[model samples]
Target: MSGTILEMKGICKSFPGVKALQDVDFDLRAGEVHALVGENGAGKSTLMKILSGVYRPDAGEIRLHSKVVSITSPLVAQAHGISIIHQERRLFPALSAAENVFAGRLPRTSAGLVDWERLNRQAKEYLDLLGFQPDVRTPVGELSVANQQLVEIAKALSMNPKIIIMDEPTAPLTDSETEQLFAIIRQLKARHVAVVYISHRLDELRQICDRVTILRDGRRVGHHLVAEVSNSEIVRAMVGREIVERFPKVVAPRGPLVLRVKDLSQKKRLKNISFEIHRGEVVGLAGLVGAGRTELARCLFGVDPFDQGEIEVAGEPRRIRSIQDALKAGIALAVEDRKRQGLVLSMSVRHNVTLASLEKISRLGWLRLGAEQEIVQKQVRDLAVKTPHIDQLVGNLSGGNQQKVVLAKWLAKQFDVLILDEPTIGIDVGSRVELYELINDLAKSGVGILLISSDLPEVLGMSDRILVMREGSLVADLERGEATQELIMQYATGSVDARVERCGR
Candidate 1:
């Protein structure tokens, strides 16, 4: 916390009928890792975009090092030593890691031709700094989500930027990878490079950030030093309320067993997996990254074929060979990556709403546009999806809005069982509450839900029973009354004491 490197004062922005930002104030200091936090559509993204030259402030002043500057484009921002790594990665899949890093500005030889050696060497150096070693020649298309995020960081660092804006950089990273990233941040701090670290993990901010700025509804709500703010205090400031008891479990009716799996295995990803989800109950699959939580979800949802397993839905064993079969069996899955597998980006809200159940809106091969609009409108209101209209493109919506659309699509299908993978990943405080209420309502209506999420608090809050996973294996099965943060963590990381005497046993 020293001299200020960048500042934005009285920033204001609007889109159509919505005021995305209003009179926001923010500043970043040299040699400091400043954190910016807010829920989706809270104006955090909009304000950062203005600072990085993606959007011009409707009314404001930007000063860099005591002198004002107008950033008209991304290139201009880069020239002024500012860069942003988006939450949704924008790397080209067809290119190699080295190529993606040096996409626009590749090294050239004397004749102005490509210099592969220099490009690979430079990319390898950055990758090494991030504790990653992969074939630079391999295309980015083959890399996992975590590895792809590292490439994004490498691209930002390649610019030798004076200020780097990281948006949810740790969303895809595992625990070890996240620690490595923190180490890299410390190295950047020593080099006097200002970093704007944006993430939903409040605890991580307390550990790494020098200062934090909270944005709500596109306005600066509060700013405080990390040492002066407690986690509960920060949550109150962000959501304007106390979030007591993060995981609030209730006694469910526990109707008939809706889903049963035995010997479920998908080659190497899943092995001998077995579980049962009952109607009017919420079963949570808790685990760290790459612990087969998502792999099991995919297997259950028909995204991946099971090498060997028997699935019994509603007490009848059946084969879920494809997504269509899963739908026919009344299984609805809000995928982990909603943008990638859950919703069609290029489609309209109305189209996506009815996508999973075209039969409901189709009459004898003739589309009923009026009937479709009515259903779409009902879901939009039911789920509180923020869109200009049903005709609005899903791609143009915010992350939370897009997620709501996916949920709406599934709700329209009237599934008996719903599998939500990270349903509230990037949503804001208010929307998270809304989702919780919806899930509770669904459970009351006898819908069996298998909730998979990385947020420990959320998993604990809404689950009737919790299952901990580690390295593709189920480590513990704890009831709601028996679960605790420490106990769940121990099982999740494989620290469970097998020698301990069981109280009931």
Candidate 2:
């Protein structure tokens, strides 16, 4: 659309036991949305980190406006009119939304004190522009994940940047919220701003991006106009092969009931939620952002208490008061926020994997190192997790790999039911297929799975039956053959009346 506004030449970066990027070259044109896509650990984030001054390139040259410049720190990057909205929320949880939006650049009065009125007013302007309706004075910690993501976007826009990098910006947002974000991106493009959009959702590229650059194993592999390449071609380039089936759903033989919830009520969060997952079955829980899918999962997993409910595991009633109670009852939950609720980031991969199954790998309260290694190694290898060693910190691995470790933790244990919440949010297309296959395998092994996802296609493809939720209640339960994207939306958005079949129940 315009002349090149930024160029990165021969960029190379390395970490211990990893060559994160290898002589990668990327250029961004003004007034265009350029997409950077790759499998996790393929160096998509690494290259962007280098550009945003989060990491320095071992060998590279960065030019902005045709002039070489060194971005030594985040402040330096900001000074150069470059801003980034990270995949992870990087805000002070204790601070108000307005305060976080203008954290470093708050308005000050003549007396050198913070001008609270102007600071909030300016912050509200940006949030309002993005169609974010939350109060500006609310603490970020109190907001929903989608609202927190909007705050990150608002913070970046407040900088009045010439270039902005958004990493998986819509992962936590609803379909409506994602559309709003796209509209904002369009407006920014009209103002001659360049955007570096990174996401695992391939379908989004054709919708909002102008050009795409693909990376594989830390090297630039392919670059093309979004209009010229098909999604299948892009998938092939990113993974180095063709993915025959994106959702390889296996029709495992259903067995006796493994999990059942009766009259589950969590005050205003969940209302009379009732569902059943038989052994060797994948029951998809589909809903919009605030349709209470996650809340139901949390209630089942004991992360939050349910005011009134009856949980049955293998036809035996049980009271799950805590995580330990849930696990003891042969239930496991892989939460949506892997970094926070799922895995302990500071721990080694091996430790995190074995953390959930210590009893199986220990003797007399002493860890059996050999048994631990054996289990962790198998899980890591089976998941195809890219890691130098088991001792590598889970935080050092890519987001997708980190998620694999979370699943590995549960896999190492004996569980009759597995609850996976947004399991493929940030995973690449290739990795997502692998996860689907893994889900099939798990179901084949007689573990009932409750898959909670906002991804409609995934729900429709992998599920034996789809349960639609709306306003904290179960609205519709459609068989795999009867479920469609449009029908699911109608049920989720209350466009259709509740019509649930007693299939699983």
Candidate 3:
């Protein structure tokens, strides 16, 4: 490692009934990317929160250049040249990109008025430096999630901090966009700025990190150079066991068709989309960011009403124009944005897990608390959700645990068709493998699954069939053995051979 720039000793923090961190220690160098990785609720975020003043550690000593300092708030941390990019973006949707980037520290003219021209110009410079050139004057809400990630990075760069902490920075980024982020990280490193990179993706650590720190059950278990340890070693340290297969895709004869879509269309977003999901099979959706994959999912789940389409549920034509209709039709959707659309952060794990099937836990305007507890307890145990208690707030749980809660909510139902949008988006490798096995188990149990993800290998490994969406339309349909990474990418990018089929039937 290079010269030590910061260190934390005996860091400890606790919430009401949960001890998030306990005597944890960490250090950073002048020009190195240190990766912090662990399973959900393993105290990775808790430790970083303490360092960034989101939470004050119960016991810890922070020394910068060998001088002990106290950081009691986010402003104090910022004053000490520390800035953090949270995993969830905190931007004003109604504001423009430039306005979001230079929100708090806007330039002022000599007359004591805000200078819009200089603000947009400087924000554009940062955006271009990061290889993101969205219209600065446009509302950020209109931009894609990947572009919003770049804007978050631009906001961090405007801070001119000595240390930058990125939490799951590439969770929503595509392959090319991720590479652009790596380039920016390297540039920051060359300027002698320390970066604390946190993510669940192990391959990213191998490519961009210098040293890796492993956390499990709120304790530091291993710290080693990326070159000294194999990825398997880190996985073992994270989950306390070996994960042989990251994607446990099963191969079995599929049953009868459970869902069939014909000529599904929405205004400008989806066009002539058609597909089928059979019982005991997993169908993967592959496409670029704006290729209408999510739009199709929404249409199926009744989140977005399709302009024209024919949907067949278990050999019977059904009209699913709303959530109630979809639920009655034996269809469900575990949406892509877990934080925004799926789970309620202000609620408890117990409440969230039983949200979808509240009718089952209620009796004619009366509530059955005992039954709800039983149902939620089983789900927590099945999903291995790490929490002090079932009553713990969902917001306090880690990203992986929150996602599990979302799944638990839908799994509580008896739906025959399930649509999982980005099922394993930001989860750890161990959790990803567990989810793959879960999906396979569901399929084996005669449940049809529609899996959507941006990861190419994930789609190729777990899916029994792949459906390629391009420019709001279904472009290709390939069976598991017939599909290849290159072939899917070609179809997804809208440059494919004539051999690829354009229709589902």
Candidate 4:
């Protein structure tokens, strides 16, 4: 409801073998939250990068307050009153939270020396506004993922920019932290700061965004007022088709148990965890942040050691003290943080996909090139991964595509059970549907799945059974027929009675 503050016209950018953006147009009005959305590799991030001076557009013109200007670098963009919180964490891991927040703009004393005390106080003030209470002196790497995200928000706000870009800002936050962020956005609106919000979570658009622009295949396809369009319509525009079923959960014949965990306990991270996944069944793991969902996944995958537990794969108790042991036992885990744990970024798609199945493709420790190529080609085609070629670096692909590569690595091998931790996190609606269909297909193929996610609807729609965790303990196990968003939240937050029938105990 205010005058136009920013406009980009005829934006065109290209990468080797990829046309990232093509003549795209976008505009922003002061005091409004405008959303940028699309499927993976749809040019959303590329356009934002251009605007934030991370990449120079091959051809485009930017007008700010009716005057044309060139943004040559991040420092220039900041000087022009622009700041961005990237989807990926960009803070210095070894630096203290306060130091990272005021990296280039640290306050100085009267003598022109570094004012450490004032810097910490100011950083704490910004973090306090977002309801985060980590010690300012602590290194950012020591903080949890959710807390690190809060630090990113605080760092962006320290610049006092006129236009702020948020890319998937809530992917790592809890419900309360997300609400606190919404409160801060409202305050930014009251102060007339324009916000460009980029997220794969379309539902948030209706709640926080004023308008939205949808792109697909490097082109601007649709733009609309948030209130005037349905989420389905937006999905159609982004994917160019009707997603009839977001979760195509097919009920396969439940066979014998494939994975069983009994009396699993860790040092204050997991407490007597017990669960079972039958062949061809999908089990949903639901909980808030810090509920030990990820910790359980890590323990089962042998990324971390457990104090006491028994893991049974196909009725055979096995000791999984390392990742190699877990894989050898037919247990595969698609970790929560794919960028760090699941896939090697510097590796090529061909290499990452076949990294786990080298033994199958090799004989006498000599990898057969023909077998390797055949496996990677099949997976690339089956998953519909949009890459120039299998040789492309995993880091060059979009978030969703990278996630598919992670799954492809595990799928390349024969496994009895698959643990997908946050499989759909930071992924677009269209990509999510593809993943859901893939899950259904995998279940139909008799691979038991353990799905861990914060999206309650995804759990309700895809799982035959839901497991809820609270404070490092399994509290409730509800069948799909009896589970609802409200009930799951109650169990996750411990608002309801914590006593419940423990499955597989």
Whichever of 3 and 4 has more lDDT, that candidate is 4
Which of the numbered candidates is closest to the native, going by highest lDDT? Answer: 2
Q: List model 1 lDDT by residue over 307-366, tens digit each.
A: 998988888887898776776677878876664566777888888887644444333333
Clashes of each: 4, 0, 0, 0
Compared with the true structure, what per-residue lDDT tens digits does model 3 show for residues 282-342? 9998999889998998888787899999999999999998877787788888977776667
* Candidate 4 steric clashes: 0
Q: Each model's C-alpha lDDT?
A: 0.81, 0.89, 0.85, 0.88
Worst-scoring 10-residue span by lDDT in model 3: 358-367
Per-residue accuracy of model 4 over 308-398 as CA lDDT, tens digit each: 9999999999999987788778778887776555677888999888864344533433346568888888888877788999999988987
Off by over 4 Å in 2: 356-369, 501-504
Q: Which window of 10 residues has the lowest lDDT sum in candidate 4?
A: 357-366
What is model 3's C-alpha RMSD? 2.6
- On TM-score, who's better, 1 or 4? 4
lDDT, candidate 2, residue 482? 92
What does the lDDT read for residue 479 in candidate 1?
79
C-alpha RMSD in Å of predicted model 1 compared with the true structure: 3.3
Off by over 4 Å in 1: 241-245, 356-384, 497-505
Q: lDDT (0-100) at residue 429 of candidate 4? A: 77
**Model 2: how far residue 120 lies from native, Å:** 1.1
